[model samples]
Target: MISAISGSVAQSFRPPAISLAARGTESVQPKGSDSGKSSRLGALTEEQKKQVEQLKKTDREVRAHEQAHKNAGGQFTGSASFGYTVGPDGRRYAVSGEVPIDVAPVEGDPAATVSKMTIVASAALAPAKPSGQDRKVAALATSIRTEAQAELAAKSRDKLSGKDESDSKSSALSAQAAYTTGSSPEKGSQIAGSLLDLFS
Candidate 1:
């Protein structure tokens, strides 16, 4: 995707100054037409709306992610994208990609993945903090975390099977010993030979 500064994006493509009315209502869809759509709107499709909502979430993430830079007393050139749309409340909300690679913590170990998930989940689930943007940001994080958990789980299952298979081999050996009850020397020799064959 062509990456450009958010400000440059806004200035470069000026959607006709929508009426103050649309700006107030933020409805990209046409009103009173009963069509539930717009011809001129660069308005998002259902999927695009979902994408934009996901992107808009980066705004909240920007707030959270940039804090690290601020604490370190560094200049934050944190970036975001634009999904051009007028909101229902008649405001211009710039949409961008949510959960930029740099914004969300990387998923490595399973426990670490869970930790990242918990932190983002806590921010989303908190009752006292009343920011829609925060909720979206957390939602994006939760999405990534869920994916990480699934990856970790699949890896664990594959690893788990190796150990389980070893246990099965041991059980087979025990079964062989138990069945070799006839203790005559010839029988013992045959049993030992059979056990060796099984191992081989």
Candidate 2:
């Protein structure tokens, strides 16, 4: 028996940071911290400029990653939410983001469950660089798909067996009728041949 589908939360690309400044600068004030406080009014130092660019790149990647999930997931996913970090240029950038997706299996319909799980797994892996949490969700989806496929196979086997049993009963009735009617040897042989054909 397959286990119940695990609940999947939003998958984030990275952890949020307070700032993108260098390690030692967190507590120390910059040379002109007061005057150059606003990013629009001051020329950024070389380090600050580099940090800003890095933040911008990170922001773009995070948004794009979440967007991929949203696009593939469609109605099953919620809007992308971001975790922000203040850059050295006094601007907020997205350091991490997540898109929540529905991962529950379809009830009572293994075929539908398989279809839904396929989509869920695709959505989980939609991003170019899938996070660990994303991979976990995809794995869960695969498990669900496997279980549903087994169920569908079982149903097909049950249907075929029931049909075979009905055919066997009909063939037995025909043979019994031939015997009760005191049919000719040729007719009895023909009925036996038919029964053999049915079984074969």
Candidate 3:
């Protein structure tokens, strides 16, 4: 009673591209060019621009590290994928599945073992969540799309010309980080800073 795809389930656990940005690093900017440009940073004051540029340099370093990881053939476990497989009956097959977690026992809780077993069993038995990876992806996609839409909306709302959409979007993004992330004020500020540069 085994299905054709059942054999390849192991391959389905391969990593995926969950990163908001693409792989690779800039091949050294022309003497004075802006590599990996950001419109939001472009709008900042001179002092702020210096800070943003420093951050950009730091981000470029991070991306280089990530690219090294990508080159080594690592993938994001969170992404869903299918893989090719071979069954005991000597047939090639394809199967789709998620990254399986090996739930170990917790020190103080006897129920932890039962809870892990129940989670694994339930994942096998229950229907998949509707939103799926699409929603997780939407976070990045919407960050751009929603930013564009909000930028237009800001033009209409402000009337006067001092502020731009990127500014408003950055502020709103900060508020979202504050509300959803629920980090301490300092950590929240740091997350907001990273999000602004990465998303904008």
lDDT of each: 0.47, 0.73, 0.38
Number of clashes found in candidate 3: 2
Query: Sorted on TM-score, highest at the top, how do the candidates line up?
Result: 2, 1, 3
Greater TM-score among 2 and 3 belongs to 2
Q: Each candidate's TM vs. the true structure?
A: 0.36, 0.74, 0.23
Winner on lDDT (1 vs 3): 1
lDDT of 2 by residue, 120-200 (tens): 889989999988778888898899899999999999999999999999999888878877888656776899999999998
Q: Whose lDDT is greatest here?
A: 2
Candidate 1 off by > 4 Å: 1-102, 105-107, 124-129, 175-200
Clashing pairs in 1: 23-90, 24-89, 24-90, 25-88, 25-90, 26-87, 26-88, 26-90, 55-96, 83-95
**The CA-based lDDT of model 1 is what?**
0.47
Candidates sorted on lDDT, descending: 2, 1, 3
- Give per-residue lDDT, candidate 3, residue 137: 30
For residues 135-154, could you state the per-residue lDDT of candidate 1 as single tens digits?
Answer: 55456557767878888889
- What's the lDDT for residue 17 in model 3? 38
